[model samples]
Target: MASNTPAPEAPFDAFGGGAGPAAPDTEWNPTEGSLRAENRSGGRHRVVKQRSNFARSSTVLGVGVIAAVGAGGLATAQEKPPVAISLPDLPDMPDLGLPDAHDLPGVGALLPQENHETVAEGRANPNPLTVATYATDDERATKAERAEPVADVQAGAGDAGEALRARILQQAEQQQASADAADKAAAEKAAAEKAAAEAAAKADAAEKAAAEAKAKAAAEAKAKAEAEAKAKAEAAAEAERLAKLGASYSMPLSSYSLSATYMQSGSMWSSGYHTGLDFAAPTGTPLKAVHGATVKSAGWSGSYGYRIVLELSDGTEVWYCHLSSMTVSAGQTVGTGETIGRVGATGNVTGAHLHLEVHTAGGDGIDPAQWLRSKGLSL
Candidate 1:
């Protein structure tokens, strides 16, 4: 083996370790323009400046990794995912009733519903941002929705709204019908009551009128019956009285001609008129009594020559005037047709006649002819 290797020199000490003081050339100053400047002190030529484009291998790898991570963080910040919310299952809640159509302002039969199909479709993609695109206002999504043959979501909502509106209309109609029925019933009831009251009033009036008429008829009938009975009794009593007179009484003078009537106007007597009926007969004609009576007086009067007063049981006085003689004495009873006096013209007479006068008790004289007619005599 050839042995020609040079021995290595000992290392120099820079921090003053057994070496002499450092030379002025050992210090480095970068402020100078260049280390290879020309020797200005006329010393050995300035060491040539050494510069190397060098790098550490480990430091290069760390810088490359940091740059790549920063680029990835920038991209992640630009793109965001849909906000995902994990909600706990809601507890079974008590039923809180929804508001009625009338309870809300302008609700008008609208009902809310959940869109489960849209929610499920979003979850199937496993990408919240991809699913968010479906709900975006982008031109792509808007165009896709417009291209559909029939709008599914809008058609479903319209159908539900129409059904709710129809139901509301039906309910309104039912309520109106019920109200009308109630009104009609009330009106009919009022009319019936009015009719009943009118009928009752009419019935009362009719009853009162009928009762008045019946009472009037009864009173009239009673009065008529009483008058008829009174008339019949009077006629019967008169007939009985006349029948008694037919058996026991008669005309005062038979076969005599009637002369002056009672109450005849004349100036031949003192009283200026005739006061008794005159019967012209023979001077001795028999004069009979009209009825049974007692003789009250038989005497001579100035104008009557001889007179006899016969008083009947009822106090009626019968006077036989101008008599020539009287058969019955005073205070003597005589029957009907019996001779009570004789016809004669004894005083104040132009001819032989009999004058008869009838007088009621305490009253003036009456016509003998009328008195006889009352006793069932036609004359």
Candidate 2:
């Protein structure tokens, strides 16, 4: 008992999926909105296939996703240029490039390129890679400029040292020369002094020899002169004595008789010789002195009985051997021709006579007559 009612069919949208079979197992019943189905295997009726909306809607959604991804990759362009960062300069270094690459012709050359400001010339490399190296070159240039003065100062110091060495050498040479000159001068002075001393010694010896010779000659001359003067004086005194004797003289008696001569032999004489002149006179006859004389002796004698003697001034004695009496005393002065005694023969005689003898001071007898004759008187 089922009821025979049909469900209503829904309205289709262009973008929706289709609904499939609805109820179980019976047979289709066509209603007012139900569609008929076809069987392809059957001869007359076949099933109807519908155009679905899912495939078309999927194609539209895929197109919209591709458009969104392409839009994100193509972003908007920037309004301003990129900002530049200045880096610190690097130290200069040796090149580190490919071997022999720098020798390639024009490899490092800059191409004709533009900047933001337009075409430019003679400017530094526009490549950002060369910026640090250019900064290093500028720093090196500054350092080289600063070191120039110090190098000049070092060069001046070297020259000053050379000058100082030269001056020291010159001073040493001058000192050596001066020392040599001084030594030479000292030697010369010593030699001169020695020569002068030798000359002085020689002169002194010569002078002393001359003085000695002069003294000897003077002594000899003085002795010779003194001897001559003494001889002259002696001769003059002899002459004076002879002159006195010539001026004063006299004979002995007034008168006398000659009895005997000298050196005659006679027996009556005492000495056996007649030593003097004899005079014969009487006992009262006066006996006279031979010269001016002193009475030497008057008295008695042994052989002549009485005797008298008269002494002259030059020490000659005259004797009257026979006398009776003496008229003068001993030591009485008598002039020439003055009576001193009387003649007598009181001794052993043949007759009365006068005996006279002459004696010199040396005790020698001479002839009385001869002595008187020499004194400017004749006996």
Candidate 3:
């Protein structure tokens, strides 16, 4: 068989050994397909590169998004909007009725429009309101007309305050004056009382002195009266005693004639002297003793026929000389007016008579007139 067919050249395998599976063709070629395949491979590489770049870009974008979110949260935490504060409006206040802004208490109104600007400014923006700007004529006039009662009240209050203060001071002064007057009056009264008391004491002393003087004068007068009375009584008693003695010693013969006197000179008697009184009578006429006495001698004497001598206690002797007879003997007591001898002319007698003689204690003849006169009897 030789046929001109080329024997299957032993199955001339393009793969060398036993083929387990069919091998891919190695020498196959397609022109447009190769080109297309090369293009497709390039396209696949480009696409993978693009996919990697896109993944990196996507990761960066996510990180940037997280940072932006974190920054936004931080900015929200750090910064905040300002809060607004609101206030309530104040309420309007009611006005108190007052005078216009220019007036003074007790004074006249001020000039017109004097404090308009100040008052307006103060009302709009009152810093510190004062009373000086209110004392204006226009304001006072306006206030007086509109608010007369308020103006009067303010004025009255001011006047009352001043008056009250003045009254208090005046009262204090009056009280002080009254107290001083009372003290002076009390002192004067005390002085007057003292003076009166002293005057009363002086008057009492004067009265006492007067009483004492009066008492002394009365005593003296009483003493003088008693002395005068005593003298008068003594004189009266002396007169009575004298009268009794004179009556007892009276002479018994009332009509006997005197023939011889005492102290007479005679020629017949010795020494020519007569020492006795003679009472002429007839013979045997009785003779008497002038007073009571004792007889000391009753005998005859030379030239005398008979005689009797009577002695008295007073040292006096009575002698009956030239008697007719002697009746009293010696040592015999004779009473007054008793018979002691008889009337006779004896002892150289010229005629018949009774002779009587008085002799002292010394035996001297004394005048019978003087002796008898001493015994409260008239000679």
Candidate 4:
């Protein structure tokens, strides 16, 4: 049996070289054979395993890179500053070549034109070019085009110009009306004030005139009362004088007989002078006043114990002396032949008699018998 022949090789199995029991069929089937079988065939399978391991590690590294990039994006989102948007600044505007109201189209033509005149009238007209003007494309248009019928443009321009003019005129008229109303109101107020003042003045004048009339009436009444009082006093005085004249003529003293005359030098006294007239009547002969007169001196004198002097209306002074007693007082009025005193010889006399004397207002003594004769008395 020692023949030089290799032992018969064992039958190879697809799963493993050792055929323990045929491996059970699994549900997973691979397109390649087992790894040990393929390795035994060649190293190509190890190379393929190494390449798959490298590919798996590279996929893990790529996943880690993507995670890191995502985390960095979240951090940057949290750390970013808030955005502040700003607007651009503008420059100041410059002046452009623009005209005032005066230098535009159509306004110069529409305004009233000025004319020359003398300066004495003191009138002036506004500059026509000072009027306002409209801004429009038609202002720059040709004259022929402007004159043409451009639908509603010509009509609108004419209406607008007319409306502006009408508005200005209406405003001016309103202002004028307001001014006129104010002036009228002021004039009416002034007129009312003047009328009131005039009325007050007239009332004052009337009051003054009434006061003057009352004063004049009072003065006239006073004057009339005084005149009546004066006339009554004169009438009473005249009646008293008439009554005295009637009483004086009724007495009988004018018929008395004179026995002796005063101032006779017949040794009747120690002085050798008779000083009175001797009536030579009984003791109670009634004396008489010579005329209508006042008894001015009726008291006693030193030599003639009691005496009486009668003052006539014409101021002739008569004296009745050698009285036993006086029956009249000073200022007592008496009529002619009225009893004044009784006869006595209390003074330097030897017989009872009356010392009759007369003195004029001029202070000159005269004979009493001569004075009685001058008064139309027979005594």
Please give, for residues 1-379, the per-residue lDDT of candidate 4 as tens digits.
Answer: 0122211332122223332222244222223567567677775332111123233223333433432332232333223332211111111111122221122232222211221122112323345422322223324545454344322233444455566678889999999999999999999999999999999999999999999999999999998888888888877876666555554533324334577786778865566766455565544466888777898889878776678888887888887777877789999988766788887776765667666777888867777776655454545
> Which parts of model 2 have CA positions greater than 4 angstroms off?
1-247
Q: Write the per-residue lDDT of candidate 1 for residues 1-379, one digit (tens) a residue.
A: 1111211221122122322223444533233444235345443333322221111112222332432232233333223322211111111111123222112221111111122222222322222211001222222235555433123323433555566678789999999999999999999999999999999999999999999999989998998898889889988987888877666668887788888998788878889889998989999999998999999999998888889999999999999988888788999999888888788898788899988899998868998998987777654
Best model per TM-score: 1
Q: Which of the predicted structures, 1 or 2, would earn the higher TM-score when compared with the native?
A: 1
- All candidates' TM-scores? 0.50, 0.35, 0.37, 0.32
- After best superposition, candidate 1 residue 272: deviation in angstroms? 4.3
Instruction: Using lDDT, rank the candidates from best to worst.
Output: 1, 3, 2, 4
Range of the 10 consecutive residues with the lowest summed lDDT in candidate 4: 85-94
| Quality of model 2 by C-alpha lDDT | 0.56
Using lDDT, give the best candidate's number. Answer: 1
Report the C-alpha lDDT of model 2 over 1-379, residue by residue, as the tens digit: 1111322332222233443444455433344333333333343321223333333223333332432222222222111222211111111111222211111122112111222012222433344311111112223435454344323323334455555567778888888889888888988988898888888888888787778777777877777777777777766765565446535665555677788887889777778888888877676787777678988888888886788888888898888886777889898999877777777777767788888889999879998878766675645
What TM-score does candidate 1 reach?
A: 0.50
**lDDT of model 1, residue 110:** 15
Q: Please report, in order, the local distance difference test score of every candidate based on alpha carbons.
A: 0.61, 0.56, 0.57, 0.54
lDDT assessment of candidate 4: 0.54
